[model samples]
Target chain A: MSGIRVENLVKVWGAFRALDDVSFETGDSEFVALLGPSGCGKSTTLRLIAGLEFATSGRISIAGRDVTGLASSKRNLSMVFQSYALFPHMTVAGNIVFGLSVRGVSKAEQRERLARVVDLLGLSQLLDRRPSELSGGQQQRVALGRALIAETPVCLLDEPLSNLDAQLRSEMRNEIRSLQQRLGIAMVFVTHDQTEAMSMADRIILMRAGKVEQSGLPHEFYERPATTFAARFIGTPPMNVLDLAPGADGLVIEGGAGPAVLPAGSIPLQLGLRPEQVTFASAGQPAVVETTEYFGADTITACRIGRQRLMVRAPGRPGLKAGDAVHLAWETSVQHFFHKESGLRCEIDPAAPAKKTRVAETTPQ
Target chain B: MKASRNALYGGLLLLPAAVLLWTFTYQPIVTTFIDSLYSTPRGRRPAAFIGFDQYETMFADPVFWKAMLNNFIYAFATIPLSMAMALAMALLVNSKLRGQAAVRMAYFTPTILPMVAVANIWLFFYAPDYGLVDRVLQLFGLGGQNFLGQPDTALAALIVITIWKEAGFFMIFYLAALQQISPTLMEAASLEGASFWQTLRRVTIPLLMPTTLFISVNAVIGAFRLVDHIVVMTKGAPDNATTLLLFYIYQVGFGYWDTGYAAALTMVLLVILAVIALVQFGYVDKRIHYR
Candidate 1:
């Protein structure tokens, strides 16, 4: 009863279709992240679900009720805005109990809930301070307090940690996840950062151009992206999606030598490889190291495989320099195939390999 | 040497404005006070030093008291009504839609019109039986009375026109303030299950206090400073019912040729305005949220 269900949500602002037939659902007490780049309709979808914006044609339900035409307040949900949206004029206590006061709860009850939320977020000392007087993280905590005090069955957050520094962001991330787990309330958050989605969300709904590109468990998105877009979007340095050409035997890296990597087909294909999966080895696909970026723990090395460039992650500094000849390797079974034009994932039997040797991939575009 | 040369150049650049302020503003205030201390010579009496004589006369004048009362009532009536109306109009126009620009311009049109012209136009609307107001009232079986000609309704009529004119002026400021308020604040309030009136009372009004303070101070000053509409419309008719302080000052100064008393009256009006502005900024400003 406490889950969210959206079906065929379409939002058209004048002539521009902001959201196109987007749909997803979250199970009871589930943590889902609407993940996409800006203008990919993730926020639009969230706004629609929150009843902030009405859909052109869609159905939205919350807690087993049809809330498609309901107001945000009537929908029985709470939202933490990207800006935190704390009232600048109100004190910390006033902000937390705003909803309770609005709903005309008794003073004793208000005080009880306010005490619980204030103590939960450690805002009791700052109860009398104005929002302007609080730090960004404190203000965010106040926002969370406001959302949690309502005791709603579901909570929604819109890129809530984007305004904080990297360190505070990670800190709040774990705090928010643990809070959600302890509360056991359904929470759906939206973010463009794959790391945030992957680390915090139990499931991720990745959107592109107003459509849901892929939606499933976090590991599913990492292990098998349904499209080239999803594959490129889900990984850091992004996945290498290379053009595949008809080779002497089968399909090879476009414009490069092969023991063909896949069986031949008329429709051009692509091969996807995560940067971490492709590592340097003694004997494998040969590449020219173009550039190397050192990041203390690991380094990202850019190498040319045929006509396309591929990014590979090397643990610790690789001591690899620009223009260095290198061999790239990955488990042959780990290669991902996608249709070149449609960008849709294409399945190839793992047992039927044109060549048994591991190979690195090239850039798709 | 370079700094001294730069200071000289800065003083040279400030000369024109300083000279104009001294000649017209600071000098007039000083001279008016000086004039208020002296008795103007008549045909049989020579000019004599009579410090505070005109001030005492101003205190004793019943018409001055009536004008003061009329002005306060007018101020009390027009300020809140116009400000509330301004806030309402600002809130209404704040939401985006088709022809929003046109609606805003229509609301602001009255503010840009000359007060004298507006007064003249309002005169017909306040006419005895054939005026727009009377005609509307006539249909409701409450007509045939002159709004500006009677002592009872004259000030009230003037107050109405003042509100109609000033609300638009104040609305521009409120509109700007309303725009500066982030939309998410309102959204958050709505999410809290706050109704329209509740949100208005809690968030909108509290956030708008700084603008309200600024508008209120301006409205108070304008109540004493503006008398052009009075000159064109009522001229303090029907036993001085609509006689504002500035208008009374004008009449005594120009009609009676009593420049000395008029200067004293000017001092009184100036002091009242200053006290009001000071009280508003000193007392109310602390309570407002600036940013």
Candidate 2:
């Protein structure tokens, strides 16, 4: 197995900078996900490292060798495209053994490897079937078979699960993760779905607008997001970001009179709260319940404190309704602060916690 | 009553197309077949039936054999060569190159111009001493070549012009098919360590079989039916070297006014085309991947 390192990778398409000075590395056998929204340069970063496209200026080294100028084939990396891109005419066996055939491997070894991959991906019965005959999930497995059969040190996947339906996506997610673990090859996958990243990756690199916003362990994205964008992008019902107002005691909630959460500072600030973090507390900040969504396993209550709204995730059948009076609370450790103007995480005061001050309750509408 | 009236409405709606097809297509075919079974009507005597005599005569005729040979050569030579050239041209324009639209337009210009006009232009090109071909040859000290007047080169010369004119038109089809192929397929091929030629052979060529089948059928029909270039350029001169099947039919029917023999030849042409159609669809169509 081998690792990949991208140093100061910058790719510009004439006027648009698709990737801007992005840098990251993967350890051998590590599963890393380049996670971000659409057009966030996550895919571009993967393509650049894969040597599918040249960076305007940067260096990419794979397996401790500079391969920035090398072709994709020379880099010895396999890729599964978003469309699967299986040769429609070739049978499953042909597609699986295509890389070996292209490299002019011995026929006996080709057959041996073909058998091994077909067995690994459970594609034995599908060996004779053409790509068109296979279901979407089967085709996805064929694509995986094609990539894995190469036995490359690193494999790149571009939104490989986006085409699958929900049930299959989760199934294939675990399958791919386990496969990568079993193979012990360094793998990097790009996805806009945070759930895929958070659940599958050993490390998640959150990108935004051609730049790396934050990259660390999966929990780091939830525990300590480097920026407001990172916090908002990595969680379910994404973290709510509220603007802050300068209060007499400290920086208070932006629009209404609420507890000053941080020390007063001239630099404007914002607060990040995860939907799943907040819960209904009797002796908490007073707010009005605006809406409630009943999920089978949990209930999400939308609470309006001042002018901002944040979702409160509570376990099963909260029996909450709109126009109900409520007080919302979360652990002090869950509060995330960012510089409002720059959107970068900043420390207002580590010592001074967001001490809840008694406040008047608003009339329920 | 409702079902019968609905049937009447459906039949009424189909009448115009059915009438047009029968008049323009089926009726002429039937009349031509009937004519092939009899001798021509003279000024005094009416037509007399002759069973298979015209076919026997046609098979025995040397000119008819020569025309068949010529048409076969034309079809076999032009179909593969032009289809290959069309695919090559399509691949060329499909790449990301400068002045791509101009190059595509240039390749297709021959298809756009009238075949007679193209033939007329090549006619001058094949002319003796002052012709463009001879002038270029003179620069290499190989001048005074009479390409069309010589029997060996006459059919070959016309074959060149026909391929030049036809390949461009065929290229439009290949180009459309090439565009329909997803680019990610090529990317995946590259990632698999397949070189350009390997990818083209293993992936592109297999996928393009449907287009090839369609183009080949058209090419086969075009080869047998083509007479415009032969009419304008060679006119089957130099021992009737360039007389294709349709051109020979035109000669027998129009020049000699042998309508019965011409009808017999037309039947042969029709049978050849029908058999080709059946063979192509039956044998080749089964193997192709449509998607």
Candidate 3:
């Protein structure tokens, strides 16, 4: 209640629903990320919270006050935009103090806040120059400085580092996360990049088709995804999901691979395994290596297990190349099972025995 | 040898433009400066160099001074008025209003219409008794006044017409600049607790400075070059009240055959334009952000 909350938020544009029945709440000093692919209503949700867009039907409250009908100016929040949005004609100091000046803050107070933000952001020397004269990274810092100077209870960020290069993006990601922690203000950041969401946010709200698919901590999403979409979206190489048929003792691969021991069930299920979980072991399911990608410290080998493609991460170079035969294996405890009809993850029964047999007859050379 | 041949080829490519420019533009400017030092030739008399005499006569002419004053007033009045109206029009059309394309077309129609034709139409509007303007005034229960026939309102009426004709053309440029602005910037401003007017002042106007500078330069040049409306409507009438510098130059050079004095007046106009161009590019451009 002391942070930002949205209840039953729905935004419709004519026939298309941009956000539908979205509800979430951030605790005090929480950093929540709205994570989704493009066109999934993540940005729309942020805009609604920022009051930049009016929700078709919803209620938004900031710091225990209902601001649903209020204009953006009355919302008492600051935002950093993807474009940086620095005023081109204004000096860095001018841009940073613009909101304070607009709010009729005293000149000395404005100067004090500006000085603090300028020093915090390392923009003291650049304060006299206009935004156009600064590099992209510097401009991004100025944008952050502007938002930080507002010192509002809530801050919104719409993919602020998207315009920067990859190197700067990571650097700014850490910087923004540290700054958010130091300020201890509730921030809702919207980004399509899962890494940005996972590395920076205290909580990640993954959205799909204008609906919240899953909301949890980064490791929770990585370990126990709520749905297949969440499973595939959170990781770098993504989770490999293989369809399996219900068998007598366990679930057998729908294709040529042997049975995998999961909890006893009759319904067909999709098995999800992360690239790191699947390993190049001595014996298990038969698989043929298709290709391998080297990432210096690790290598991910793309292999075909029965007809499904699975990526197996191996330490350093596995020395495996395309067209090579190999065996893929993983611990049954680390496997995720999803219902085939609905893509939602299925929980394992705790009473079931953990014993699982490795059928060497199905193992590849 | 090869570099010399390449230079020769480049010179050949530039020859046509260089020749055309020298013949039409450079030659006339040089001839005008030369003629300004000599007195106009009369019938059965040859022209003679008089060493600043033509300039002296031009400086002494009261009508020339009046025309200079009128041009300055015209430029000062029209440029900012047209640019402001253009910015307003651009903002209106840029919104998500119904029939915006049609509205934009209607606003831009005046820009495409010939000034001579537009002035003819405005002449009827400014006519003394039964014009459209007088009809509107009568509907308001006020008596009809001579808009163009009086010295007080003549130049002002011309300035109004120039603003109307030029605002829409400049609106196109402003609209382009407005469209180029990232919509996210506006959203970001709103989230920063900026009001609509504050956002317009801090973000929209500042971002549009380059376009404004470009349009202002054109407006300044047009303010001096454009006299077709004057020719068709006022003909510098009402005791030379609406006589702009270019119109006076035309009247002297062609109507009175005072070519030498006309050349001197042309030099003054050129100097004014040069000064404006220099101030704009050298000073204003340094302040505006191009991107």
Winner by DockQ: 2
* Model 2 lDDT tens row, A43-155: 89988888789999989999899999999999988999999999989999999999999899999999999899989989999899999999999999999999999998899
DockQ in order? 0.72, 0.80, 0.59
lDDT of each residue in B165-270, candidate 1, tens digit only: 9999999999999999999999999988999999999999999999999999999988888899999998999899999999999999898888888989999988
Q: Give the per-residue lDDT of model 3 (tens digit) for B227-263.
A: 9999999899999999999999999999999998999
Best by TM-score: 2
Q: For model 2 chain A, give the 10-residue run with minimal summed lDDT.
A: A356-365
In order of lDDT, best first, we have 1, 2, 3
* Candidate lDDT (C-alpha), each: 0.90, 0.89, 0.88
TM-score of 1: 0.95
Better of 1 and 3 by lDDT: 1
Clashing pairs in 1: A241-A364
Best of the candidates, lDDT: 1
Candidate 2 — which pairs collide?
Answer: none
Give the worst 10-residue stretch by lDDT in candidate 2 chain B: B39-48
Query: Which DockQ-derived CAPRI band holds candidate 1?
Result: medium
Better candidate by lDDT, 1 or 2: 1
**Tens digit per residue, CA lDDT, model 2, B1-291:** 999999999999999999999999999999999999999777897889998889999999999999999999989889999999999999999999899999999999999999899999999999999999999999999999999999999999988988998899999999999999999899889988899999999989998899999999999999998798888887788899998999999999999888999999999999999999999999999999546
Off by over 4 Å in 1: A353-365, B1-18, B41-47, B96-103, B139-142
Q: Extract clashing residue pairs from model 3.
A: none
TM-score of only chain B in every candidate structure = 0.93, 0.96, 0.96
